[model samples]
Target: MEPGNQTHVSDFLLMEVTDDPELKPLLFSLFLSMYMVTILGNLLIILAVSSDPHLHTPMYFFLCNLSLADICLSTTTVPKMLVNIQAQNQHISYTGCIAQVCFVLVFIGFESCLLAVMAYDRYVAICHPLRYTVIMTPWLCVLLILVLLLLSTGDALLHGLVLSQLSFCRDREIPHFFCELDQVIKLACSDTFIYTILIFFVVGLYGVVPLCGVIFSYTQIVSSVLRIPTVGGRYKAFSTCGSHLSVVSLFYGTGFGVYISSAVTDSSRKTAVASMMYIVVPQMMNPFIYSLRNRDMKGAFRKLISRITSL
Candidate 1:
């Protein structure tokens, strides 16, 4: 009768690459296109940032990190699913499955922390314009990124280590493609109370906590923008963070929606689709989000194009 009171099914049967046996061909082709776009789009962002010295800034630094994380995140799941689809066998070894779960969690954590850092960077740039350059110095950006790497390293390892102790026996089939964290935990032969508790804690720390930081940063930024004397100045100030803000909204909104979907619904198909929005779609969208919203990058691209043409 109620939502939280609803029982969670122990395991989900991964619907995998296709629902329709006949549509398998079409589905494979579509997913292949999406996966290619995700990898190529994200990789280009990394390349553009690395080769273009003028694009080196705290924003671009974090953008590059996000691109790399997206690449890793999508690669960990989609490729395996594609292989399974192509071969007509979607079963993953327990060990291979768990490894996928580990990396997905790690990369998700990595992206979460990176977005938090980027939010703070924008906050500093907008709220403290005079100190923006000094505050977000190249060394500081590097250190910030290094800190995220260390944070993700621990976050990913902890979940995997905890999951490693789990014994799977009742259900070997994992619902959805690749190894999802919740789906893997569901298969554990051991009591999942501790695992469930740990999931809540980690999700809160790695997911909800960063949401608060992003909100706080934007709140301060909005306050600073409101104080600007001219309309042009206020809009100009807000414009700087528009792309990142849109991306943040898209990412967290879709992510939390999946969590809610998995919570309320019992269907594996629904969960699989919801998961794709955050896990796969964002990988494809991240490069375009930055490219269209940020002006500096547009200028950098133009100059890059001009120089190459001259050569």
Candidate 2:
């Protein structure tokens, strides 16, 4: 639509996963369940790590932050979706969409950076075991986390600012469940070339760089693991990293799948499903992957549960 022909829109209609009236109840129930599980599972991870002295290492400290970010990530989109579904109103206000964009960016960036930091922690633990403690000092951990938070906040605000400059039409309908940055930009009446450039830059910087760091860290970790002589020792070494590797794979795999699906197909419904797999599934799965696979997390969670029950 031309800029002069566009009517200023205060709200946008979110695309529904299905137009079938019969599916609304099913969709609502399914999403609500997923959201609740994501919250509860990640919250338990935070509590387990915080309350257990044994889990007070740099790794679990990052895990706690990751859990918190997962909660935030799930929260940024799910509740609004649930509300819209229940109310049968797909409208999200202009200000609300902007807020959604900001929070999602912040939380996703947090997850991405935290994963990279976790990978680095694994690298130090495995590759330079003798100097691991000295290398990943508590101060350094805090500093890294602070830097991530600052960077994510700045990036989110910058995206939001750029997004606010776009002119949207009256029948503003987002092709996804939430006000995703890209989808919102696609609806703009004005030029989005600059916005596209910003996205590419952000993806390269925030997404690709951290992901490459993870791959590099794991490469070192694998080499170090391979050098261990005994099978038992090698198993033990790999076991330590198993949970983290799983979470990282799930996070990036689903994320990449979403991007690929979006790019390959014109089906918004399929893209929305892929987005859910990216955002909701990983958050819901992280706690389970860690708690079930890692002995430390399991022990901590059991103690946490037992303590709660006793109280």
Candidate 3:
């Protein structure tokens, strides 16, 4: 059947995280709490960066963008899942599902690129302290962000457009809470060779290439740090990167876990569970990781809170 003829399709059924009726409320509360925390934490990070003149550097600028991306990424999936759980109806409109896929791709791609950019920022700050201010100008930072946004949006729209062309089986059951790209692709009744090729190209370009850039940036950072003669200088240099390193590890680790789980196991439920680590946990944890590890972020948060309370 041609995809054009399938315009009558109204919705797709999203599988719940569990079949046990008793666990629904618990799952709902858990996810709700996590979602709230993710939002609040990331928001505070943004507010702190904006409010504090001390955080007006390239690192915090990138951090602010990362926080925004985390909020967006979490918002893209969690609320819809929460809505489904609350309504006890796992049905998502066809349009909503496609929109979710597009936003997820955009935010995910943007976040990946932002992390790589952050690593480069750190590399410059540490390896070329004398040139840091001159090199990372405000215009360059803004341009990098604009370029990343454009690329991510373009990639996501391309995928969404291709997805709209594929016919789906009558059994439009997506085996995950959200309309995961791979699961949605599995539902297509038409040939998905082109889609598969596109996925590989995107993963290679957005995923592998950024990861390599991060690795390269950190390599230079490490080499420069090692050459520092004093232990205190080394600690200070490494400290600057600790928060970003932790985030990168969590992001990639959980992301890799999702891929491995999906590959090794036939259980869709397990795959969904693994995805929570990637999609939910990191956003929730990022604020804590930055604030706790970095003195500057901690001070910024305190100052922001003091101002808020004074009002």
lDDT scores of the candidates, listed in order: 0.81, 0.90, 0.92
Query: Per model, how many backbone clashes are there?
Result: 3, 0, 0
TM-score order of candidates, top first:
3, 2, 1
Shift in Å, residue 27, candidate 1: 1.2
Give one digit per residue, the lDDT tens place, for model 1 in 1-311: 12221122333345566757898888888888988998888777777777788887788888988998998988898888778888888777656776788888889988888888899999998888899998999888899888878887788888888877766655567777767888777666677897798889988988988888999999999998999999999989989888999889889888989989999999887888898767888888888888788887777667766876899
Q: Write one digit per residue (lDDT tens) for candidate 3, span 244-298.
A: 9999999989999999999999997899889866899998999999999999999
**What TM-score would every model get versus the actual structure?**
0.91, 0.96, 0.97
**Which whole-number lDDT from 0 to 100 does residue 227 have in model 1?**
91
Off by over 4 Å in 1: 1-14, 305-311
**Model 3 stretches with alpha carbons more than 4 Å out:** 1-8
Best by lDDT: 3
Q: Could you give candidate 2's per-residue lDDT for residues 1-311 as a string of tens digits?
A: 33343546778889876778899999899999999999999999999998999899999999989999999999999999988888889999999999998999999998898999999999999899999999999999999999999999999999998887778765588888998888888787788887798899999988999999999999999998999999999999899899999999999999899989989999888998898778899999999999999999899989999999999
301 in model 3: Cα distance from truth in Å? Answer: 1.1
Error of 3 at 210 (Å): 0.5
